[model samples]
Target: LEDEAAYDRIASYSPYDNITAKPYPAILAMGGLSDPRVTYWEPAKWIARLRDVASAGPFLCRINMDAGHGGSSGRYKRLEEVALVQAFAIWAVERSAA
Candidate 1:
């Protein structure tokens, strides 16, 4: 964590520090409440920061209450999440065309 250059190189891929004055793309980030790999708050915070810095973007995030990294435990619940993701994609595309 103390390696400044190394951390920068790795984190360069992340929008956290890379987002410029340019308008950001409409991003739809998903998080699972029970996810051990990526806690739900990570995306929530990222969206907030994106809103703060990016010139534009209807940044959106969804946190599944009954899920882990692999997503909801039930098939029906997982399907619902999948549908939501697809819908978000469509909405973003349409919004961009407008």
Candidate 2:
């Protein structure tokens, strides 16, 4: 299962539903705003869906920015992403402790 076929197979089955029913140890989602392969919107939608349906909605954090697919040329965008990652990491650690 590669490419679209794999995606189709996965989409046909709602695996996330099963996963969402359980308490998540943690959930972190990161995506590029200008990703050519998979747009940022997809993950944003996913995060919304997860939050709506997942029992552990509070554990999910999504980070995305308007930086073009890789290389990190946009200074402000990269800084924002870096900040988000740092914050999410700290949050995850603290949340797990509690």
Report backbone clashes per prediction: 0, 0
Predicted candidate 2 versus true structure: per-residue lDDT over 2-37, tens digit per residue: 699887777778544344555555566666677887
Q: How does each model score on lDDT? A: 0.86, 0.65
- TM-score of candidate 1 on Cα atoms, chains taken together: 0.87
The TM-scores of all predictions, comma-separated, are: 0.87, 0.60
RMSD in angstroms, candidate 1?
1.5
Native-to-model Cα distance after best TM-score fit, residue 62 in candidate 2, in Å: 5.2
Instruction: Mark the regions of model 1 whose C-alpha exceeds 4 Å error after superposition.
Output: none
lDDT, candidate 1, 15-68, per-residue tens: 566766678888988898999999899999888888887877888888988789
